[model samples]
Target: MNQKQSISYVISSQSSSQQKNYRTKLTAVLNCTRLLLMQELSSRGHDESKESLNKENLIELLNWYVARRKKINEVLFSNAPRNDQMTSPSIHKDLVHCCAVETTRSMINEMGDSLFSILVNESRDNSIKEQMTVVLRFVDKSGHVKERLLGIFHIADTCAQSLKDAIDAMFPTHGLSIFGLRGQGYDEVSNMSGYHSEILERLNIEELSGRTGQF
Candidate 1:
């Protein structure tokens, strides 16, 4: 059988007696923990620790879960180098991040060397550190308006220079060139895009320099 068919057969052949394997139990525990974490994060609007959850009777139930869930993360992480192996709900989360990055890169590539604009924004967590995200607005190869989400970035500070550096680091790695960028959309932060902001002006100048070098 092919690899996919082999997996299907293995799954279809699982009898009740074979369901008690450590790997099987580990999978169930991981699924339960994931569901609980999602519910907790949704209800609390942030990440919660086992310590914070220990006050509840549910903690006892989850502790039983923990007993069975041991070593799964280590096994999971050892499986591969993709972001999924390092993250819970690994396959799904990695696919989401990958889609966001790939869709944006594809849109930019279809822009056909025209002037386009990018928007940047930041979201903050409980620790109050800002994480930046970028979006590109462009027309795709089929002449349809498409907006694609770029990847989230780490903003070490709210300063303009830091934002520019982050952009610099992200641009080349995605096969994106800033040569034809015509405008920038930023939040109402004065330091980011104000008239006298050296960082913002420097980005525009960088785009111009890239354009000049293309000719």
Candidate 2:
């Protein structure tokens, strides 16, 4: 039977609660997958906006997929009622947060006790607030080098000390330690490069003191 006929049959055969449950699960999966894809694209320098991934667009994409693939249509739409879609904005936000957490966890796991270097840079946003962005570079278990965007932090100022302090405060939250940092890099702009040298000196002093039991 065609997809529409199959869906009609399933709707008639399935109970309302069953249809709702199927749709809820399917929506959650599709939303999480889409959010992850969008994040990957964004990281690769693709510009994306919420309107591009809005609920209506997602629903249309799902419908198109169902129309093309017999197996996917049978599995996803078989018990899902046409009107029982779950596309709340709040749910989408929650899914996006979940994807972020999962991606960080996976990155950390792949890092696996390896020493990583950090590349740091600062920029002001549209609001004129300075923010520092850090990216971690390391070799995974398979011996391939990888770089992941660790985080972006709002800073009180872009001074060397303030930037160093911000990174010091951030590492522990993710179970990372300055001791694991083998190297650091910063933007080649004169002020930023100065910050890089000062921060490296500070980190070296701290590492020495920690090992030697001296303040």
Candidate 3:
């Protein structure tokens, strides 16, 4: 059987308590290593600790500390006022935006002076809002090709010009310039294909040779 099948079979054969015990033991091993590293750092005067440095004692302390913190957090969250909690819709949206910004920054850093092409498409979201999705394709410093979704932008319409304007507006926020584009791709639809020449003329993207095709 395959590795996944083997793992599934093993998990299915084990009782719930057995699985729990196995996970607890695995966690303890990791915690034990962390505690040992902390003790080593303390010995080097990089940190200070008053707890016993014995292996078993350190493992027990870490297990207790983790369990206590988990319990405390659960209790606090259960009792805290809903408005004071961090699980609000706005908070989640902010967190997601932050993650997207950081991820895009990292991707750009990886691309680092390399020419990149963009793939663009327009579609209606579940809410029937017209949105344009942009993706970047490039070779990294190590010569591996990478493709990353740049962003999805809400547009006023699905016309070629509207889609092109939306993409243009997004570039400045990400510190990108139209001159850096080496190629462009769009869905082979009537709305996009019919205006290919117009888009090429308006954007002055000479690299695309007045045509749009898949990357």
Candidate 4:
């Protein structure tokens, strides 16, 4: 007839072994307000029956899982800062500040007995306009050699004065001073390496005078 009547009929007609299975237990839960069959299944150590919930409890559990799933979906699709995210350009100020601090520290480390050697080279572009690239090479406090490109400036003339002014401007901008210079060198070109160029001499004198506050 109905689920309750069927469970009752099975329990009365079938052997106890058949009655103990979920078939009967499920029928009883769907039909009977009293859960006597469920309790018997529990006493028998039927794990499925033991873990089973009543209608109200099952509905409550389903609601909880539904709410939990909604929350998880929201979190997954939401715009939030995730792990391993890179800093954007909006925060580049912090990155630039750190670079400045490192530059200052590097200059401080080059303070004592560090050789500041200038290597100047000239190259012409497609327009045949010559440009000078100055490289500052020195040993840091850790005894490891370091070098950096000072600048690459278009030179109106390869004369010592123009190259010197461009090179000199770059030093102070980086919090560096030429007084640390201990050596001078240049490419094979006469304007930089040759005595006739006089650029190297001016650099040496400029550096020396800087040491004594002459400039």
Expressed as tens digits, the lDDT of each residue in 46-150 for candidate 1 is 333544644342234434554666644334333333442323445435534554566566666677665566788877867887888888776666777766777
After TM-score superposition, the amount by which residue 210's alpha carbon in candidate 4 deviates from its true location, in angstroms, is: 14
* Estimated TM-score for each candidate: 0.50, 0.61, 0.59, 0.42
RMSD for each model, in Å, please? 10.6, 9.8, 19.7, 29.2
Tell me, by TM-score, which candidate is best.
2
lDDT of 4 by residue, 1-215 (tens): 47656857756786765434334333322322123223433211123232455434322332343365643223221222352111222332343445445655665556545657777787888899979887778887777887766556798877767777777776777666666665666666666654576765666665475454422
Give the whole-model CA lDDT for all candidates, comma-separated. Answer: 0.59, 0.67, 0.64, 0.53
For candidate 2, the per-residue lDDT at 188 reads: 78
- lDDT value, candidate 1, whole model: 0.59
TM-score-wise, the better of 1 and 2 is 2
Considering summed lDDT, which 10 consecutive residues are worst modelled in model 4?
Answer: 41-50
**Backbone clash count, each prediction separately:** 0, 0, 0, 0
Predicted structure with the largest lDDT when compared to the true one: 2
> Where does candidate 3 stray beyond 4 Å?
1-68, 71-75, 78-83, 193-197, 206-215
- In candidate 2 the C-alpha lDDT for residue 65 amounts to 69
Residue by residue across 112-175, what tens digits does model 2's lDDT show?
8998888889999999999999899999888999999987899998887787688778788788
Worst 10 residues of 2 by lDDT: 41-50
